[model samples]
Target chain A: MNLHEYQAKELFARYGLPVLPGQVAQTPEEARDIAAALGGTVVIKAQVLVGGRGKAGGVKLAHGPDEAYDRARDILALTIKGLPVRKVLVARAAEIARELYLAILLDRSRKLPLIMLSAAGGVDIEEVARTAPHRIVRRHIPLEGLRPYQARALLKPLFREGSQLTQAADILMKLWRAYSEGDCSLAEINPLAVTPEGKVLALDAKVILDDNADVRHREWEIWRDPDEETLGQRVAREKGLSYVKLDGDIGCVVNGAGLAMATMDLIKHYGGEPANFLDIGGSSNPEKVTAALRIITGESRVRAILFNIFGGITRCDDVANGIVQSLKQSPLPIPLVIRLTGTNEEQARKILSENGLSATTSMDEGVRAVIAKAQEVTA
Target chain B: MSIFIDKSTRLVVQGITGRDGAFHTGQMVAYGTKVVAGVTPGKGGEKLQGVPVFDGVAEAVAATRANASVIYVPAVFAADAIFEAADAGVGLIVCITEGLPVRDTLAAYHHVAALRSRNGTGRPRLVGPNCPGLISPGLSKVGILPGHICKPGPVGVVSRSGTLTYEVVQQLTHAGLGQSTCLGIGGDPVIGTNFIDALEAFAADPRTEGIVLIGEIGGSDEEEAAQFIKRHVRKPVVAFIAGQTAPPGKRMGHAGAIISGGTGTAAEKMAAFEAVGVPVANIPSEIPSLMAEAMGRRRPRSNRAAAGKARRARAASRPRPAARDRARPAAKRARARARKPARRAVARAAGGRGRR
Candidate 1:
């Protein structure tokens, strides 16, 4: 649910924050038109979902329309951190006499939205945190919005007492409004630059929306980035499966989120590494099992697959049938280990046995058997 | 010895007649829970699993006097269901629905907490928004935990994961150890009843001689529980945490099961448990023996039916990965304690019960 920089800036501008006017251009011709209209030096930023765009040579400055088109062409052809640049943002370049950092984020440890401001900007905050810890100022905003005085206090040391300070504080408040109203998990402006003309503007925008809060925020759908989602994730989402791929050799398919976690933990404990975290949820649809195996076996890193089902409301027979059906379509190269118990366990075992496969009832035994089989395959 | 419920405990089922509601309701009734009433708007007169249905929480409460409510409502209306149950004077509410929006949960938590403060008595204690509820095994059951896997015993179990809780409880039952009460506090980002709340109840319950805490990579609830054990708990405690190899920034299946800002890792949580004098188990199967060690006794030999499987599980046990406790080797010390088997549970029960 991460919003691209242009989209985040749009929300920022909508909330009355000072963000430079920008246009998204998918082609070099559009970039030329946007650059010509801005009339001054424009910044061409690659619109990819990854950070470190400057480090990756995706962001460049252009003085005129021709230069803007050339820069956009170069960026659009480049892939930064495994994501191809699809579009470029042409924005009016701002004159910066000083750069400051600001962000409002939900700190899980504090259970509060933290307002952070730093005198140092235009660099990784992790680096700043490591080098000089005292340069940053942070305050927790409890359910209530960040107050004016609190915002001023965090920004006071970064700027002198003047219109710049007042303007920065105002923008911070507006940013808070955008953050809460938009149900954002993170709202950040890396460089709140102070121009020579004494105007403070948000130079870069980063906003991460909370996916769980989408029940209320229907207007944010246009901000979804399909490239950010892996193919496995997209397929799982469409099939109503909750899956997050990992890097290991043992693949897991379990019912219930908690069970999926424990299955992974048990795999690690038994001297095996889990390749992914996949939860089919409470439904015992055979089709979900089929799709889950397809997703897991599709991974090149997976050496063996494990299915741990403690059927409560989920019927074991459906899962067994799904396993048999999937194997019939195309037999998986990796070995499969399944542990089925509870609610029609006998029927599930009979189905698996009839399909020339067997299931274990003990979780420890199942994990051990899978690890051994996976090891044999690797050897 | 059970902490939450027993035979006489009355229950109300919210979202009754729905898919999950009807299915789990049948399980609860079969498990001997006193399911007195159900609530589902427009399905008031319908009978579900022979339980009387009402339109709202207030009507259901007035007619049946259900002191506890377990909600199976979807995430959209789940928060209101909590408010409705609390407003109707139910003392205990268990929410089993997952995927509840965090904003809605925050509002529900505050509303329930505020009502308790204003009334000054009979405050409702909420279990979870994404949890498997609690079971006082062999007496009464609420929520979705399978009843047959557990047996009544002196061990009290509290966990954040439903399946891991079942895995550990089943292992304990297989090893001839029974739980006085087992509860899954849930894995959501913001849950109502934390590990501390469950630990506090277990500490006060006379039936619980030892406790097992199963935590995953998540919030600082496990660390707080370790601290609470140091200050107040007298019962022998054993702990296990999942997601040891979980990569940073990955969601790891649960909403709250992510390592954020270099904290909430399983290694840190295991260290916290060690610092507070509680034994830690590396895997779920080790939980029963660790709890036995904490209780200063040997695990009673399992029945003949499970003997072969138990032997195979023992044979499959392997050395765990690199110990995260670089200097202390705190978990190894816990294994050492298992060999000595000091009778702390007997001494504590005889030591005038250590003043609350």
Candidate 2:
């Protein structure tokens, strides 16, 4: 749910935060047109989700419309971190100034929204925290949210006095509004820049909305980037499964979040790599299991498919029936191993046995079996 | 003797008329939980599975004297349900609902913290917004845990996962290490109960001779729990953490289960536990052996043997699942069939969304 720089700026503008005017263009000609309309030196940034876009040469400065087109074309042709630039954000370049970092995020430990401000900005906050921890100041916002006085106090260390501090505090308050109202897990302005004229502007914006809050904020659907999702991930999501693709040979399908991760860990521990992490979730039926199997088998790199279901509310029999039904439809070319236990496990074992597919109940045994099978396939 | 629930827990099922509510309510009642009443707005005066239904938690609490409440409402209404249960003076609120917005949870959590019960008994102890509720083996089953896999004994288990809890509990039972109580505090980033709360309760319970903590990569709760275990817990505690192989920035199914900003990783949490002298199990199956070894190390040889004998005798004396309860799968399968249309609609609406 990470918003691109341009989308984050759009949200920042909606919340009345001071942001430089920017337009996102999908093509080099569009970038040139936007630069021409702005009539100034423009910065063209690749709109990929990964970090270090500038380090990857996906960000370039252009003096005019013609140069903007050239920069955009080069960025568009290049792929950064395996994700091609689908769009470029063209904005009027800001004058030289000091950079400061400001962010509002959900503090998992405190279970509250935390606002962090630092004199050091426009760089990786983690690097700053690691190298110069004292430069960063943090405050936890209670349920009542960030107070104006608290925002002013947080900015006082960065800005001593006058309109700069006032404007910075105002932007912080507005950023809180965008964060809370937009149901964002993180809203950041990394490089809250001060111009030579002393005016402050957010040079970069990154906002990540809380996905669980999507029920209330349906309008956030427009922010979803389809290009970011692989076909397997999209299908798994549509089927109500949690799936994350990784570069491994053993495809994992498990019942719970913790068990899924443990399975992946056990696979790695047993000298095998996991292709993906997929959780069928609680109360599974045949179709969901079928969907999970289909999604896993769709991965060509997956040499062996593993089903590690420790059924509680999710009946083992249901999952067994799903495996049986799925294999009947389109038999897997890869080695298939399953470990079923818990509720109705006897019946599930019987079901699997009848289909000529034996199962193991021990997780360690299953991991060893799957790793062995996967290696055999690889060999 | 359990940490949170036992035989005296007069339970109330919120959203009793809903699909999940009805199914799990049946399971709870069959497991010998005293389900005194049910709360389903607009269904007052009706009966669900022979339990009286009320329009509100206040009325339900007043009439039936239900001290504990389990919620199965949808995500949007879960926070309000918590507020209602808290306002009505329910002593223990276990919300089984998942996908509650963090904002709503924050509001509910703070609201409950600030309010005292009507009877001046203190604020209600909220267990989860997404969890399989606690179980006291043969004593009482509060939420959706399968009771057949559990056995009452000396071990107190706490986890942030549903099926993972079941896996570890079943392994403990198979290894002749029955549990005194098992609690799933849930896998949400912001839950009412956490590892520290459960660990404190386990530390105080005399019947809980040893503790088994199941944690995953996420918040600093596991690390904090490790510190608590080092300071307050005198009993032997064994730990197992999932997501050791999970990549950073990926939400591993649970809303709280992610490694963000280079913190909350499994390696970090595991190190925190190891630094505190707590033995961390590499896999779930290794938990029982670790617990046994830790407990054996704490007690003398004769006392350990005596405790094992006592645990075995107590497990033998406990009643098994009734024959009628053994016929549960058919009913459960029927309920699963009935829930397909609704589940499909929800999946359709939430297609390709981010992790819940």
Candidate 3:
């Protein structure tokens, strides 16, 4: 659900924030055209989902149209942190006299939105937090609302001159408004520079919209990349199960995420690796379990499968039926360890036992058996 | 003796009209939980499994005086269902629905917090908006979670982890200790009640003698709870932190299971618990003994021996590459150094053999 830099900046512009003029270029020709239209120094940046693009040589500068085209072509050709750049952003470069950092993010401990600002800019905030946390001034926005005076007070120390402080305060207030109204989890202006012309422009803009609020924001949906999804994740999404693929070899199908993770961890603890994360959720229907198993078995790395269901609303017998059906539907070659508990557990055990699959009530034994079985195959 | 539900706890099932809801509700009521009423909006004055079904939580509360609620509502309407239960003044709200939008949960959490602040009566306590709910083994069970794995005893259980709670309780049951109260606090990022809140309640319960806190990676909630336990908790507590060597930078089962940038990790949580004199266990099998030792029923055992054995077992259990990860890298280095001259000699001998 992460937006590209151009999309974030687009939202920023809509919020009335001062962002450098930019154009999203899907091709080198479009980038050259954009650079020519801007008629000034341009910054070409790779449009990747991950951060550290600049550090990974995904960003470059050009003085003229040809140079801009060359830079964009280079960035589009490059891979930043393993993600290839299919597009590049051509932005007019701003004159920087002094750089500053500004961001507003949710502070979980305080249960409020916290504004972080620093005179130092254009560096990873984590490193800044680790090295000199005191340099960063934080102000928690009260539920009552953010006041312009408070914004002015925060900016007052950063600028000795009154005019620069006033201008910075106005921009900060606008940023806070965007953060609150735009449903952003995070909005940052790195290298929020004061130009030689005595005006402030956001040299770099980053915005992370809350995924939960995305339903209400249709404009934000356009920024979503459909190709970003993993095959298992796509299948899980379609099947209505919360599935996140992991790197381990032991495929886990459980009733809950907490339990699913615990099952995966248990496998790891017992000397097995989890192939994927699959949660059948509260409604442990036969279809959901079947889909989950299909997704797990799709993973070639998975040598064994672990079925852990704590069936509260999900009956153990129903889950057992699902497992039996999955086994019947596909002649799965991997070893299976089933731990069924809660309501109808006896019935479930009966079903499994009838199918010649001995279910274990003991999780330790189940984990041990699964790990042992996986080990047998890998060996 | 249980912190929440017990034998006499009145229970009502929400979304009882749904197929899954009716099935689990029937199962739960059959399992001996006092089935007072059921709630499905616009379906009041009906009955499911011989239990009265009310149109809404308020009507259900008014008719049956049902103090406890188990929600099986869809994720879309889960927030409204929770608020309905809260508004109806239910003593305990256990939501079994997962995949609630983060905003919906935030609103629900905020509403509950606001309710708590406004009431001044400490009226209803929220368990989960996404959790599997609570179960009082041998007494009352509300959740759809498999109930047979647990047995009523003195070991108070509190966990952010749901699937493993059954395993923990199973181990405890096998070790001959029944659970006083077992709670799955939900694995959602912004949950209603946390480990410390449940632990504090467990600490106050006279029937409870010990606690087993099942912790996972992500967020500082566990570390904070561990600190609180050190400062305030009186009951003997055993800790088993899951995902010790979980691969970093990957979101596993829950949104909260990812360990990135060194913040809520198993190792860190274990260290925090250990600093507070709480016995930390590495494996699920080790939890029962740790709990026994904490309760003064067994002697403290060496974790080193268990670790060594687990390492060797794990190495033997995994693929060759993974087995190498568990191998002594220092030993590998030393062997590589010793083989340097041998490799040179072999190369020279290979040259001679080729010449011949």
Candidate 4:
């Protein structure tokens, strides 16, 4: 749900905010073409979702088209934070008189959108929060959203000139529109720069859309970065399961988000590392379990697969049936341990036993068994 | 006995006639919940599972005097459904719908808050936009929680996750500890109820002798709850937090279960609880014993042993289908019971530390 700098800028531009003209280029030639068109000193930024791109040498400033092409080539060849640079944003660089930070994000504690403004910008906000806590000012937006007067009041400390304050407030209002209308969890402008000519421009943009609001904004589907998704994640998403890959040997499939996390924690507590976190969700549709197994088993690093199901709305029998049916289709090479309890648990145990498999009802017992089995496989 | 719903809860189902709504409504009715009405805008004047259906929440409330409403409507209409339920004067609103936009939840939450300020006496309590709802064991079931996993007793349970609540509740039940009420406050970033709200209720309720709080990596609700427990709650409280191994910035299934910007980590929450003198359980199964220790700590020195004996007796009297269903021999069960003291000793040793 994270948008690249270019994408965020594009969204910002659509709201008539003062964003530098930028173009995304996948190749050096395209980068040259964009740099030539902009006809000024340009910044070539790697289009990756992770932070610290500049520190990783993925961002470079170029004086002309030739330099822009060379910078883009270097960036495109680099892998920053394990993600290969697939695209670069070629934008006209700004001449900043001063830099400021502006953002509106959903504050979980307040259960409302919060506008955060700071005099410090172009660096990690968290670092600023830790070191100079007084620099940042935060105001919670009401259900009606960020009002124009509220935006001006929030920005007044950062801006000295009345015209500049009004201009910045207008931009803040536009950013709020983009955040609320586009259903964004976060919309940030780092280094809201005031040029020597006294015009304000957003040097960088980062926007994270709320995935839960996808129903309202189906058009946002085009913005999804397929490159960011692992094959397992993609398949899991298609199967209506939540799966996150981790570097471990014990693959865990559990019901509910909290239980999935708890299952992972228990695996680690028992001295075993979990390869993935998979939640089949509340409805115990047998197909989801089958899909979950297929995804987990697809990871060759997994030495053992553990199923921890505590059924509530989810019936344990459906999960057992899914496991049985999956094993029948293609047997697992890795060891499988299941701990089933709660609703329809007896029926689930019966189904597993009929298939020459048995499940423990105790989470501790099951976690211990799986860790032992995984260790055996390693040994 | 319960903090929220009990035998007096007259429930109404919103989006009744829909698949999930109809299905869970039938389950609630089967669990002895007094489901007085159903609300479906177009499918009114019909009976679903012998419950009368009405055109809207207002009509349903007027006709049946349904004091509580559970919504299973789709995410698009969920916010309006909350507004309707609140406007219709339902005192307790439990929304089971998931994937509601945060904006909608915020609006609904503020609307309810505004109503609370305007009309302080009968303002409604909203449980969740994405939760399994709550159950008062043997008295009433409101949402989708499986009632059989619970039993009527002195313990009160509140959690952020659904099946995780069941996991801990089943452990408590197997340990011969039943619950007064078990509630899931939902895992969305914005929810109607929070840990402090539920903890305060449990602290005030006389029937709730001990409290088990199941929290995960998310907002500082658990940390705030820990503070609330330290300042307000005198009851024995045991806490368990999930997502100890979860990496930062990844939503671990639940939309809200993410460790963002070096905050909302499980370790932080656990530390908060430990600082507040709440026993933090390392695993879900360890919660019942931790609850026992917490409760035992509050009693007089001589009564501690007597309380332990009473808890063991209660556990022994319960039909332990969980152990028996493993198909283990009787001798193995006896050996497992014999090893309980050793496990308890280990748990006690690790009690001072939030994490090993």
Q: Who wins the DockQ comparison?
A: 4
- Sort every candidate by DockQ, greatest first: 4, 2, 1, 3
Per-residue CA lDDT of model 3 for B189-293, tens digit only, reads 677888878988898888888899988887778888888987898778988887775666555566556665557778899999999988888777777766665
Residue B41 deviation, candidate 2, in Å? 0.8
Instruction: List pairs with backbone clashes in candidate 4.
Output: none
Q: How close is candidate 1 to the true structure, as a TM-score?
A: 0.87
> Whose TM-score is higher: candidate 1's or candidate 3's?
1
In the range B7-56, model 4's lDDT, one tens digit per residue, is 99999999989999999988998999999999999888999989999999
Looking at model 2, give its docking quality level: medium
Q: Which stretches in model 3 have alpha-carbon errors above 4 Å?
A: A159-167, A170-182, A282-300, A309-313, A327-330, A333-362, A365-379, B11-14, B19-21, B297-356
Q: List candidate 2 stretches off by more than 4 Å.
A: B116-122, B299-356
Individual DockQ of the candidates?
0.39, 0.57, 0.25, 0.68
lDDT of 2: 0.89
Question: Candidate 4: lDDT over CA atoms?
Answer: 0.89
The alpha-carbon root-mean-square deviation between model 2 and the true structure, to one decimal in Å, is: 10.8
Report how far off residue A283 is in candidate 2 (Å): 3.7
Off by over 4 Å in 1: A25-30, A73-87, A107-111, A127-136, A144-162, B297-356
Candidates in descending TM-score order: 4, 2, 1, 3
TM-score: the better of candidates 3 and 4: 4
Local accuracy of candidate 1 as per-residue lDDT tens digits, A291-374: 898888775488899999987667789888878887888788779999998778899999999988999998889999999999
- lDDT score at residue B216, model 2, on the 0-100 scale: 97
